[model samples]
Target: MSATTAPASEIQPLPPAENARATRETASSAAPAAIRHYLSLPFAAVLAGIARYDSVSFWPVAILVVQILLAFLCDRHIRAHERMEPKRWAIRYALLSAAAGASWGAVVVLWFVAAPPANEALFVLACIGVSAMEFIARCRFPYGYAAHAALSLGPLVVLLLLQAAPSSFALAAVCICVSGSLILFGDTIANLIAESDKLRHDNIQLIAKLSNETREALQARDAAEASARAKSTFIANISHEIRTPLNAMLGMSQLLDRADLEKPNRDYVKVMLEAGRGLRTLLDDVITLARDDTMTDNHNDSDPALAARAVAQLLQPHAWEKQLRLSVNAPSTLPRVAADPRRVRQVLLKLTENALKFTDHGGVEITVGVDEPDDDIPAVHFSVSDTGLGIPPDAAETLFEPFMPGDASYARRHQGAGLGLAVAKRVVESLGGNIGFKSEPGEGSTFWFTLPVANASLSGATDDSDADAEVTPPSDLTLLIHTGKLRVDLALSRILESFGNRVIFAESRADAAARAARETFDVIIAGTSDAEMLAATPGMRAPLLAVLFPNDRSPASGEQILHWPAPPRTVYAAIRDAAIRKEPAAAQTRDSQEVAPIDASAFAALEKSLGLSTLLEILQSYIKTAENLCENLAEASAAGEWDEAGRVAQDIAGAASGLGLAALTATARGFAQNVRNHEVEDAHTLRNQAQLIVGEHARTRLALASLYPDLAA
Candidate 1:
């Protein structure tokens, strides 16, 4: 057993005989029994020193010593020989205790068989000590230790009681019960702690992984936004650069004379110039849309009329070129709304341009009306309706999306990238408004939108420029003093002069106030910006009319402040209303009450003929009819009911067509034509679309009430 040689029991061996020989040879110096009996050293030594006791004590102690020794040796043997399963790693240490516990069971049986208990008290005491250790082990390895404890203690307690050792029996039973309870309690606590540890470890790992993933996602988002911004900047810069040179080239070309050149040469130059113009126009539209997308925080509650008039004036040529009648109607005292004038003008121009482009026979009309104040904030609604090639029923809502052409074939017929509506929609939404359309395939479409208006009374300025200067000069109308820009003053003056009215001019607020103090004037027509200063003068009872510009950043003081976006028309209307009024106009007047009602007879008759008297009826009928039409169309396409489906569509079309419901008629006709031509490909989709077209007619009729007012209840 030298340290250099190592113990013989620790050596590896092949056979069972070899293993036993090695174990014995190592223990020779100590005692050959020492290697063979590892755990029994204490028990064996104790027994050998003690005097012989009663058979009860002797047998139980001897058996217990033998099993403990055997258990220790066997545990060493198993560990050396066997490998553990990775999957069972959780109970690796516990498994060793479980194997040791098996030897306890063998000892219990041997003790009972060797000698029946004479003094059962001694047997019970030995049993109690052994079982307690077994129970502790059972808490580590539930099944193995449980078996050992039960066998070691169960029979000993029973034998003690049978021998009239009731106290010993009761004590043994109590010890067993406590041991068992401890084993169960320890096991539960161990398992709960293990589970908690496992969950905490997993949560820490998950949090680390999530943090890494979030960092990656944020980085990607930043890169994407940066790339988008760069691209937009590049487009805007390049477009502007290209347009600057392109504008010069086109202007020079236009200056070249056709009279000095051959007809064909002139035509080639003209074509090239026209192509450049078109490209420039496309570039301008792209830049505008891009600018609007990026621009922020430029809101002003100013004069809206100026912006509206500018857009109308810009688009007038386009409308006139197409022989389409265009008119603008803005009220005299429209509440100033917070908006970007350039963007607003751009939106209006785009809509009007689209209307004129598509319309061949009918007209485009632009109307700006101030809706009654809601929530102390009035809204100004701008409507652009046109008689043109109306939108397809299926394409109306999609019209505002980028690059979505209604008819691909008609794309060449119209020279546009279909970005007009897209740009307009974006601009309107950026200004806190919405853009929507109502159109039929043939009759035309009306696009309407609303924007917030600044309530007049909330504003600080008041128009009291001319209160004192008065001569009850004539029964006929006469303008004592007029103040406006050149174009506005001249236009208003010419209009009044045509009606045999006298006119005076004041270019600025100072001049207008001076005229008010010195001379007599029947009425004062001044730009809205100067109206507040003029109205503050004494005895200025003559009605004050304001001429507002598109970009004039003045707040509306009250309804008395006329925000005539179209200065000419609003000025004329105001002058007429003021002159015809029985009492002198108040300092603040409410919004005009001269709203025209929309005609409902046509709508009502159409509804009645369609068997829909109310909106509910209309909606229900639409749903039912849509469902039935779709089903019939689908079935017909499958069963070759082409002629019947075509006839049904034609009938529907005829009814809609006669009533000027162009959108409905167009959809019905498109379906009917498809059916007649045996082109009922995807009939289900067409049927659903037909239902929507019919439904839109009902919606449009209802929407007209708000627009036309007469159809309201």
Candidate 2:
């Protein structure tokens, strides 16, 4: 079992510390098996000596037996204490190996000297076989193997050389070569064992480290998910709370504007309303940022031109206040775009407002038109160019990061939360569009974005009533409307009257039926409940327009339905279509008077300027004020104090507008109007007002409290 040395290149050397540890482990592991081999080999030697007993003495046999007994003792000790340190065990095994080798050498020397010259070759062969067996057994421990090989063969070699014969010298030289070869082979085998052991140790350590890192990574992921959930809950709750009072304030202010006040007071109310709306806009931006996922839905066909025009109108008041001209320049024929009209309006509002806020001298111009096709999708381009202080080069990199304004100085003239561009960028990107800007400091800036055009088929299907196309109401038509709620009735009446239409109101289905029997109207508009009944009424000759609320079921096929809370233009378009039984011709001009639910920009500014603590206090104060006003309103209404109720509604509108709660403000404003018109005498009318105000307040409070749990607590 002699070992052949492998090529040095095939064996990788281990570091000194690792090599030492490897060697100790290898030796300890091989000890038990090597001990068993030692015992067997010595037994074989003893049996051979007995076979040659006629020619040799019993001394050699006795020596072999002694070596076997020693091997047995070492094996027993190793098995009994398996937990013994490798290095200490290896040393003890080496000593046992030395003793075994010396005993074998003595037996060989005795036989060689006693045997005849005829048996000299047999003894030499026997010595070589024993040396080979020793090498195989102890090779894993090179030092121990080397000692055994040399000791076992040394006496035989010396005896042969001292004979002074050529054959004897040749035999001695062969023994020397065998000894050297076995020692070298043992060393090579030892290195291979060391490298193997070191590799295993390294692998174990690497696996442990990987497991630990994986555990930490999982923990981090869990923590992140928890934090995300908490953040989402907070945003939803805070948004509701903040919006409640804001709506109340804005609604009250709108109602106040309608009161017979002096010009100065009217002007102040207008300013307050505008400021409140602005604040609501800012709050919306913050909410949008926190709820980024919401922006991904509702991509519908929209007119880029109309959206641009609406933005121009919405900000025109601000422009007028700043004494700057604001105009929208859109192509007469622009393609309908694939986008969310609300989001588009939001983006435009942000850009234009930023432009208006920054510009000190020149006007802001909004341009909308078609751009070169991209990926075979036609796109509509919208740009807001303002003669304001252009963005600085240094601020360009972080300009689109939320709360990072172009002018970040604490004393900067224009105050903002710096979320306009950030929000615009996010919205455009989420809508599958690109947004960027070109600016020269102290000169002006142009911010632009592009939305893909709507599919040709969709655009063509509704081509007659193009979203950008205006539809003029038939001023000479006599319209009869079935009234339900006071607010809806008043709003619809005012809208229809402004267009020069002679409108008659029906209080119930019976009244509508009666009115239909008497009047020959061009168009009959009724709430969803009375639409069918009025249409079946005797002597009814006019086309029916059903006003559907949000929760209303879908109208029957071929039925003309108008969604409530629609823009005035939409109402006119519906009426014109119902009256003529065809799409109305596009008018030259149109105006949008719709108000947004919240103003994101103003809210952001308030949040940034007031710090979290101060803002929290403000929110707390607003909640308290709103609660008091709600109680005051209920008391005033119960006492039939119409004037006091109107005053209370005005106060709520002021508070809501200041906080940018547009929806609540609008509701409160309508409630106040109903009071002023003495329309709250009816139980239904009074109940409706109370429900609207209370519902809005509850929503606002819940939203705010959710956002700031501390406030709720």
Among the numbered candidates, top TM-score falls to: 2
Model 2 per-residue lDDT tens digits across residues 628-683? 88998788777766666665675565556556576676677667656645656785
Give candidate 2's error at residue 684 in angstroms. Answer: 55
Worst 10 residues of 2 by lDDT: 585-594
Q: Estimate the overall C-alpha local distance difference test score of candidate 2.
A: 0.69
Estimate the overall C-alpha local distance difference test score of candidate 1.
Answer: 0.54
C-alpha RMSD between model 2 and the true structure:
19.6
lDDT of each: 0.54, 0.69
Reference-based TM-score of each model:
0.44, 0.51
- Model 2, position 24, has a per-residue lDDT of 56
lDDT digits (tens) for residues 114-163 of candidate 1:
55445444544554554554443233234434554555455555554565
